[model samples]
Target: MAHERIEVDLPLAKVYELLCNPVHFTKFLERIDDVEKVNSQTFDYTTTIGGEEFQWTTNIIDNLRNTRFAWITINGNLNQTGTIRFTPLDSGKRTRVDFTLDYRTFFGEAEEDLAAFIEELPVQLKKDLQTFKDLAESDTFKDEESSSEKVASEVA
Candidate 1:
């Protein structure tokens, strides 16, 4: 089990919106290669871990708007469950994100390597969280989203 937290200079709703979008994972997470929606609440993804690529599918178990996002791996090399919670701070101007991951390490015939990977999981997760922070706070992300929404509204 690994737990991590980070505070970001963004509203809870904004952060929650990012988390709820599965496609955003491929964009923000360095290890993620692709994210394909399987259904409304499920996605299939390819990710690189320790220089090896793994294919996985996950189902979104809980999605409490602007508050929490949780998922469990349905098929993958490892069995995993994770949750991310968003809490508003500074009167809803800032958000505190808490992330938790619980997983069983499985690396085919490479048992020894799994130990090292497990030890590094926390650091990797923290880095991923920081990457998310940098992305959410970036002007390019905001501008792109805003313009896309504007175009969508115009088309509608």
Candidate 2:
């Protein structure tokens, strides 16, 4: 299991909106190569780690609006489950994100390999979280959100 936390200078709903969309993950998560939405509640992700590529399908098991989101792998080479919680701070002007991921290698893997992977997981997760923070705080993200809202309103 690995855990990472970051505070973003954005409203809870804004941060949660980005987190709920798998397509946005590639923008912030370095290891993620691509994400395909299988359905409203499921997604397929392709990622590369240490020059090795992996694919996984995950189903969103919990989604509590701007409060919490959780998912578990349904099938693939990777066995993983993760949860992200959003906490509003500064009276909803800011958000604190807590991310937790638990994963394991396939059976029969070398013990040393598993140990090394575990040791490096936290460092990678921290870096990814920082990237997420930067993305959430950037003007590009804000502009994109505003544009999308305008488009939606026009369509309605």
Candidate 3:
């Protein structure tokens, strides 16, 4: 079993919400083009990489607040299961996100040759997380202010 972890500078709940929402992926994830929500706990996305596109569907296996969420790949060109864990850091000023993607060979057979793939997954994932962190810590993350706040600012 190979493991990788990344910590983005956002609250755990914020990170969890972003990861579960496929609709917001394009704002940071480069390989994912679009996502269609099937229901409250299921979704599908079209992911493109290296000029190749594949459709994948995932079911929400677990959902928790400020802790973790797990998912299993339902249908896709590959087979994998993943988990995202959240840990509070610096007394809520920061959060550590740990993501792990586990998989076997396409035929369910294991071999030593697979390390190459595993080694690169974390690098790619970390870069994506960093981008999200930058966006989250900036002033442009979707602010959910109420109409009264908006009106007051406009009046001012």
Pairs in steric clash, model 2: none
> Of the candidates shown, which would achieve the greatest TM-score relative to the real structure?
2
List candidate 3 segments past 4 Å from native: 1-4, 49-51, 102-119, 143-156
lDDT string for model 1 (2-22, tens) is: 799999998888888877877
- Residue 84 in candidate 2, Cα distance off native in Å: 0.4
Model 2, position 126, has a per-residue lDDT of: 92
After superposition on all CA atoms, what RMSD does each candidate show versus the true structure? 5.6, 6.1, 8.2
lDDT leader: 2
- What lDDT tens digits, residue by residue, belong to model 3 across residues 20-92? 6555656665545666678877777665444455567778798886788787778876455667788888777
Where does model 2 exceed 4 Å of error?
A: 110-118, 142-156
> Candidate 2 on 96-142: residue-level lDDT in tens?
99999776665556256445666777887899889788767884654
Error of 2 at 63 (Å): 0.5
Q: How do all models score by TM-score?
A: 0.79, 0.81, 0.69
Cα lDDT for residue 30, candidate 2: 61
**C-alpha lDDT of residue 147 in model 2:** 30
